[model samples]
Structures are given as C-alpha cells and as structure tokens.
Target chain A: MSNKKSSKVGGLNWAKLGTVAAEPATRACYDPTGVAITLEAKDEKASGGEGIVYTVPGKPGFLVKVYKRETLENPSKANAIRERIEAMCENRACQAMKGLAWPLMPVYGDASRKNLIGFAMRACKGMPFSSLFNGPASVKEKFPAWNRRQLAQTAVNFVKRVRLLAESNVLVNDFNPANFWVDEQCNVSFIDVDSFQIADRRGRPLVTHTYFASHTAPELLASPSALNRPRTVEHVAFSAALVAFQLLMCGYHPYSYQGVPDGGGCGSPDENLRAGRCPLGIGADCRLPDCWYKLWSQLTGKLKNAFITTFRNGHSAPAMRTPLGDLEFALNGLLITMAKDADPDRVSLNPCKVKSHEWIQTPAAPRSFMPRPAYPSRGFMRTPGFARPPYVPQQQYNPQGYGRFPTPRMGGTTSNFNPNLY
Target chain B: MNNNTNNNINNTLGNLDVMNPAPRCPVTILLDVSGSMSGQPISELNAAVAQFVRETQADEAASMSVELEIITFGSTADVVQPFTSMASVTPPAPFVAGGMTLMGAALSLAERDLAARRELYRAQGVSSYRPWIVLMTDGRPGDNWEPVAKRLRAEAERGKFMYIGVEIGNSADHATMCQILPTEPGPVKLQGLRFKQFFRWLSDSLKSVSASAVSDQDNIAYPSVASWADLA
Candidate 1:
C-alpha cells in the first residue's frame, strides 16, 4: 500500500514528456519511427502528459496503456506485449495471477529520440485504487454485508489468492483496498500495475537506467548496501507491505503503521523513532493507529514484555534490518495473531488456512553477508542520448506525493484506469 | 471483450487502427563507391550487405516487418537492391569503384525508391515507419548536384524520406562535404571505412525493432561513428 496521499505536497511537470524532444540535425537511424506509426490513441490529461494512448480499441477487456513519449500515440509494441501476456495466460495459477496483474503491455519504443516513447494496449474497464476508496459510496454501503458467511468467505479467498502469489514468488507492490476492484462478493482483478510492471523495452536500446526508479520498493533506493549487492532488496519489502495491506483492508494491521504506505521501508525503529518525514518521507501527517503504535513502542521498550519485538533488541545493526527470510514469518505471525484475536464471526476475511509447516523457509543471505559490486563512475554510466537518470529518477514520483501521484481525470476520458473520482 | 465490440469500434469511429494493426518500418542503405573507396571500402560494404541479409533473415520479426532497400551511385545512379527482404536479397559480389561522383543521381534514386517502398509496404498489409534514404559518397557528386540536393530538401519538407549522406577521405573538403551531406540537413556520413560500422549499427537497430513488442522504436544508438569518422 503506497501512502494514501504522499502528503509531501510537491508537483513536477506532468506535461514534461517533451523534455527529450530537443531539436537535432538529421539523425542517422530511424529513431522512433518503428513505434510511432501504430498508436490508436486517447489522452489521459491528468496523467497522460499531453501524450496519446492507443489501445487495442475493440478489445474491451484486454489491455490499457500509458504512453512514455509523444511521436508515438500508437506503436507496434502494444500488440507484442498483449501477445506475450496472452501467451503467458495458461493455467489457473497464471489466470489468477493475470487477474491481479497490472498487465504488461508491449511497446514499440521510439528510442531514437533522447527520451524513448512507449506504446501499449489501453485497458478500458479499470480505475486506480485511490479513486475507489474516495468514491461516493461508503465502504460498508457500497458493499452491503452479505450475511456473515459470505463475508468470511470473501476474506478467506482474498488471503488465499495473496498467499499463493507469495508462494509463487510473484509480489505485488501495493495491494490494498483500492488497488484491486472487488465485486459484490469479492471477486477481484487488479488494475494500474504501475510503470514498474508495465514498462516496455520495444527492442530498441531500451535500457532505461532511470526507468520508473521512483516506483521501486522504497528501501532499495536508500540503501548504500545496494551499491555492492545490486540484488532485489525490493521484492521482500514490497511483499511485506502487500501482507500488511491485505490485513489492513480486511480490518487489521500486522503491527501499526499510522504512517503513509502503512507498511513500507521504515528501516529500523531507531531510524523512524523521531521522524520529521520518514526516509521514504511517508509524510508527517500519517500516524500509526494508536493500538499498533503503542504495541510497537512498548515492544521496543516502553511497555512490559510485548510480543512485538523485532529481530533486533540488543543485536547488531545489520541484524536489525528485517531480513527477507524472517519478513514473511513476521508478517504471517502478525496476521495469524490478528485473526486469532478477532471475533470468530469475521468470515469474509479468512484469506488463509495455516498448514503447520507454512512458515518454514531457508534463510536468505543478508546485505552484510554479501558485498555489493562497485558502481560505475557517473561518467561511465552513460546512456548516450538519454536525459533522465533512470529508475524513479527523482523521488518526485512518490505515489502519495501531491502532484506526482495518480489523480483522477475527467469522466469521459475513456480511460479504464483512472485514479478513481472519489 | 468480444469480437463484435472490436468490429464495432474499428468500424464505427476513429478506432480501426487498434485492431487490424500492422508493424511499419522503412529501411535504407547509402553506399559510397568513390575513387577513394575503390578497394577494401567496397568489399567491406558488400560484405556488410551480406551480413545484413543473414542477420535480417535470422530475425523473423525484422524481415517480416521492415521494408528494406539499397541505393548506390559513384559515376552514375544504381538501385543495388530494390525494396526487398534481407532474407531474399543476394548482395552483389562487390562494388569496385571508378567514376566521378554523381550523388544527385543516387539521391534521385533513393527518393524514388523510398516512395515506391512506402506504397508497397502499405499495400502489402504492413504499415510503415518514415522511409529512410541514405546517400554515401567518397568525394562530391559530379555535375552541379544542387538541383537534386534541392529535390531532397523538398521531399524532406514533406516528411517523405529521411536522407543521410557520408563524406570520406582527405580529398573530400569538409565545407563541401558539409554542404552536400549537410550534417544539419540531408545525409548521415560513414566517414571512411566506417561504412561497416554504420551499416552494422543500422542492422542491429533494425534487428532489435523486429524483435520488439512495442513496435514504437525509441532512440536507437547508431554504432558510434565517432570512432571511425575522420574528425577535422
């Protein structure tokens, strides 16, 4: 769950896709021509950055996209990504996976320009999670309680879906109330998989060093250890957040996060104890719910022997960071405890059924255990015609940030993935 | 969701391109066969053509998607390969050089060939990228090439073709090469034996496009011509 509102209150040019379009003399290659000729386009003014989005227009339920460049309102790669996803649509597991995915669209990229343009299929039926929560209907009214039994089943099924994905090593970054659309009985599908999952390479020199870096798991971006490790420190963090989100939407919190993005890279408690803004700068306004915050603080030292102690009480600094191996166990333990303590009447939220050995897994290597590789000199880290620094270029893209975060567009924009009008 | 919705959208409004889509790309090769390019230059150029053919053939996506052709002129004009598939193209053994320059004829051939190829690609069930017309010359085109040069400018004004020119050797005047090639205007040069590097970069880029899902090409780095270009 990314912070509801980054609460940071900063805005960057949403119309800056033209930054890479500086004038050049006749260039040698067909810069962006390969992808430019195919857009079946529409514009999402709020987020479309004055660019166009071409969809597989007729296929209502198939794809939706965001354009990264201007010349290509439409591109050939849209069909390609649709084809690949279609190919991967085998088995119930994959089907379920697809159901929750912010589908990957293939893009014909025009990389000849300094900034590459991307093309993909446009999804027509979905909206962003943020929109759903803020929509006109209250949560309870929009979803009338279907007698007690149905509620329990909904929760169980939801947990089952998330747990399976976790077991499969497929982690969803932000999985909370608004991210997925839940029908009356909780039948669900995901939308807005984020640029992280939707990014297209389009066969050109598509190595975007700065591509959606801001959309990454927060901890990875801040870690100096990542310089040498160069490993995915993000997946585990994102997954834990996913677990926390699952619990929160189901009426619980694994621990307590009144902060933005409920369970994100708070790093160590010592790091976050007296925060001006979370390192993630989750924001000053969001505070953890009282109960969880009390428990967290007490477990650290404020209260008598609390059950919420992290792996580091008197241990070392590296041991203090939530190791990936224990992250799942910690989250699962919290969920199990939450469910156990909750009224048994909560049927709709029973998303998991613990098999005794569920929490067993091999311990992963810690950042301290493995040294990261030396980074290239800033000069050598060149993308010849590229302008941005790649991968979440600046923190401006914080999903909860005022301007950079997703916002609702006009109703008739014909977009399936709006941030929701609530 | 259903084929009917697809048909309706494609047929009713401005949405047909969404469904019955085709990948579009136009590829051109500019060859330099000036007196200075007599020996290894031409052999390597031809060899690179063969290489381009094999590479494109292996790349199922590119051969099927891009419209490719070649234009070469030294003393006179020539269409070495009409808009054809690298898969089916049989490059000539080699182009041994002789004559005085006639880039005007080469550009003339390129302009004509690109128009024809673009039409052919659209007609043959494939959409196309902007057409590329490369002009490679060792010295300068014989005859006052200004008229043909004017012709290139007109075509470019209409976005009909993307033209490139190359200047090679000490005999080639930088100011004059700049005039004919127009780094700011008409053509992209291969510098010297850098024809190999230029073509290789081109083939690599096309190959990448052929394999890409997003038919939209972002910026493709041409083989760094900096290495071989004779910096004045």
Candidate 2:
C-alpha cells in the first residue's frame, strides 16, 4: 500500500522493478543504553497492510517491522504507536511480556529520531499456528515430532501466554491463529505486538481496529456498525475461550455448527455468531460430528461447564462468561493427563466411526523401515529367489449375536484418549 | 465381543495405521522427452529435475510431506518412478529423448496414478491435500488429448486437484497447451530453459501449501511465478 519507491528492507528484494540497488540509505538507531546501531534498509520480499518488514543485520532472533512512510505522515497516529512502543520497551522486563514476542526497540528513520517508522520484535520462526489445525498431512510433515498430546499442550501454552499478557495489563484485542506460531517443542509465541491494546497515560485502553469474524465474540459481532471500541476484559476472555476451543477441539471454531437448518436459524457461522446461536449449546437442533461430541464428553465436568457457560449462558451477558483463568486451569489439566499417557504407537480413536469399525493408529516405526537418507528410493536390488511378501488386508468383523458393541477394555491392547484422567 | 477379541481387533487396526504413512501431497510430473528435446532441452530438464529433488529434500517440511512421481512421455508414456516422498526418492536417471511425444498417454497415467493414490489415502483414513499434476511438453501429442483435457478441466474446477501445463520452447504447440491446461493461469511458456527456476518455484510453492492448515488450504498463496515463466 506504500506508494513510495520500494527499497531493500533486508535481504529480500521487494522492488517493483525486481532489482536491488548496490547500496541503499542507512539509518542510525540507538539501543536503550544509547549505543549507536547502524541499520541498512534492505529489500523485503513480503509486505503487509501496515508496512514492509526488514530483517536487521546482526540481530539473529529479531526483525524490524517498518511502517510505510504514508503511515508516519499522520503525526498523531505515528505518535500513538511510538508511545506504545516506548512503554512496552520500558516495561520489557515484565512477566507478561515473557511469553510474548514483545517489541524490543523503536527504529527511527534518522539519527535525529524525527521520523518514526516501526519497532523490532523477536521473530517467530517456527511453523504458523495454521499448521496445527490445517490437517494431519501437514502436521505429519512439518512437526513430525508432534502428536495429539503436543496439540493439547499447545492449547494450554496459548492460554498461559495470554494469561501472562493479561497479567501485564495488556489486552490482545484481535486474537486469531494468524498472530500465533507453535514450535516443534509445542511452545507458542504471539506475533504482531503493535496491534495489542495498550493502556494510555489516562488509564484508558486503546481502541482495537482489527476483527476476525470467526474469532470475534458474539457481543462484538452484534454491534457490527460500531467503530473500533476499547476491548473489554470480557471480550478478551471470549476471544481466549474461542482460541482454546479451536486448539483443543481439533481446530473447530467454537461457533461453527453442523447440519442444515430448517430455514429458521442463522445462516452462516458469521450470522450464527452475531445472533448468538451456538448449535453446540443448549436448545440448539444442530448436530456436530460424533467425534466432536465424544471429545467434549471426555473433558472434565468443570471444563464442559466452562464451555457451556461461555458459549451458552454468557452468549449475551459479557459478565456471565467463564473466567479465562478457570478455562486455562481446565485446559492445563487435560494436557497434563495427555502428557502422562503419551505413547508413540497408541491408537487415538474417533467416535465418529461405527463401533465395529477398525480404529486407526499409526505406530512410530524405526528408521529401518525407511531407506537410508540418500537416493533410497532407487538402488533396490532384488536377490535371486527373493519374492515380494503377500499382502493381507486387516479383516473387519462383527459378532453375529452381539446386539450392542461391548465397552473397550482399558489396559488391554486397546486404549482410548481419556480426557478425564486429568 | 470378548475383551481379548476387542484387543485383537484394536491391535490389528493399530498395525494398519502404522503401515499407513502420513497424508501426502502427491505430485505427478509429466515430462515430454520426445525427439525434439533430444539435446539441450532434454539436458536442461534432466538437470532441473535433479535440482528439484535436491532442493525439495533440503526443505524439511516438503521432504517428508510431498510425494514425487515421474512419468515421461516419448514413444509411449512410462511411469519411471512411482509416487515416493522426497525422503526416500532416488536421483532419477537422466532422460534420453528419442521417440514421438505421447502426451495423452502421459496425462492418462497421471490421472490414474492420482486417483489410485487418493483411494489409498481414503482406505487408510489418512487426510490429504489436493494432488498436483504438472505437465511439461514441447510439442503436440501424437494421440487424442481432448478427452483427457476435458477430464482435467472438470476435475480442476471441482477443486479435486490442480493441473498445470507448461510449454518448453517456441516450437511447443501453445494453442494445444491452452486448450489442455486447467486453472485460470492457463499454460505458460518457460522463459528460455529456466527449468531449474521453474522446479524451484514448484518446490517452494508445494512447501507453502503443505504447511498451511486445512481450512486455509483452499486459498493457497503460491510463490511468485515471475521468476521463471511469463503468463500467456
């Protein structure tokens, strides 16, 4: 959106002409201790609504988010961002910022510091949060080390991160997966520090401009025509709860309903959310996948109550929503139970399938099953008298006289994802 | 059912799951190794294929997720390599260009292979991203290609899989390529023998697609095509 001529922001070339200048203009910045740091604005390959992000040399785990010159032209808006950056930097040692990829230092256009472009933050280099919920195919590829247990742990991590942010009096007004990243170790980091609602000197929270309809609270959706409002604590809690639901429930948006309506209910997810009609909650006719209900049933009574309270009872009343801490506690407990029962060859059963149907679980085989690293697909030598093994498909059986499926025997070869163990 | 029988069934099902690998983004590369590409064009393609394998292997995400396949069309289309992940892929044998292009046969093989792979995924209960069929040619097909083109367009429109066609050089039948290619981008002309660049872009794009979540899969943000080809 920047009309100004694009230059090298980092090593990425973003010039419209697709050519880089041998040397671009350099800007001088100072660390908190007043140590002079020289930064050369290099070409950036990626751009966003705000401005171009440039990688600063000598900074291994940080990137500079430089706003477009047009943004800086608005002195009031520029000053507002600058104030937030300075306050965040001053309180950099706060516990809340520990889990956040908080802004580190503000970058000025010149040594005189008249033109403020953007600030630098710790770069989240791991897989995007989308990887966790996208599908099993991607999850298997990118985070090969992750399993269902890790996913549960990731949800807890997000809750903890948000809790820490709230403790520091920061409100993550605009919450969505796009702003988060999860590493192979299941550690979650939040990006886009600039958009966080900061408290003004007068103790008033800044207005939140961004909104994701899927993740937005019903109350906020009801007032669609309203201008950006200061996000309330209840609003933050609703967003956190939705995120927790999405992560814990295998990426199902809390308001996403299944089954065709009888032409009387809210039409789409956005409409359902705005009208506060949660199909999963009380008096709703919609049905979810049997697996979803099974997953929900496995949750501790308290956790189930919390969801009902937030999505059903608190659909209209902001004050009636389940507290974020309570939700975090329940999620943390579930993940702990998952960690205790994590097994590589364990079969994670989905209730969506018929009881007689085979439950699928892929075992973590040794690397021997895989050929050696280099060109393994080739060089297969067939020795004399070597015959291919006969393929025998697994047989599906149903007992002739058994009227009902027998309950799975626990501690035998069959084990299920029991959420109540926590 | 008895407890022992239940356990037995669960164990058998568990083993099936173990044998069933992760969901794969199957990519079938249909190459035109006909007589016209016997010299530099064939060599560039060979080198580019090698580069594609190497680069794809280097990518941590793509190496494990993307299943690569090679089907070359000459006098007849032959599946030189069945679908295999880059993790296990062998360095392909250098192509020897000689016979007439059997592009129709190559497309037929691609469609068959993709359909079979999807069936396998379904049987295993393994979720999959949409499959990709990349067709590269320098000339018109010796056999009928209309039926295959119609099927490809229909399937692509239904969001079943992605079909990409690229003409190798100026001698390529551009009109035929347009008629056969799916997707709005249509068939593109490779800038010179920029096969290496084209393959690199393909690998990178696959990496991005493979990394995205299921809900976001439909809106794939592909890497820039400007680096390798011009849209025709």
Q: Could you say which candidate leads in DockQ?
A: 2
lDDT (Cα, tens digit) per residue for candidate 2, span A1-422:
11123212111112222231222356565554445566665535244545667666777767777776656668888887788777776665541344466777777766676556677777676666654543444556666766556666777888777765665567776675667888878888787767777676666666656665556777666665652666665677778888777666555555655444442222334455666656553345554444455545445444555665677656666655655666777676666655564332221323232222222122122112222211111122234387733322211121132222234333333344332211
Lowest-sum lDDT 10-residue window in model 1 chain B: B1-10
Give the Å error, residue A71, model 1.
Answer: 23
| Candidate achieving the largest TM-score | 2
lDDT winner among the candidates? 2
Residue A130 in model 1: shift from native, Å? 34
Model 2: lDDT equals 0.61
Reference-based lDDT, each prediction: 0.38, 0.61
lDDT of 1: 0.38
Per-residue C-alpha lDDT of model 1 across residues B12-55, encoded as one tens digit per residue: 11111211122445666757676767778777777777776776
lDDT of 2 by residue, B166-212 (tens): 78888898778777865354566788999999999888877766654
**Residue runs of model 2 more than 4 Å from their true location after superposition:** A1-63, A67-96, A112-114, A122-157, A167-169, A173-188, A197-301, A304-322, A335-422, B1-26, B53-69, B80-93, B112-131, B154-162, B211-221
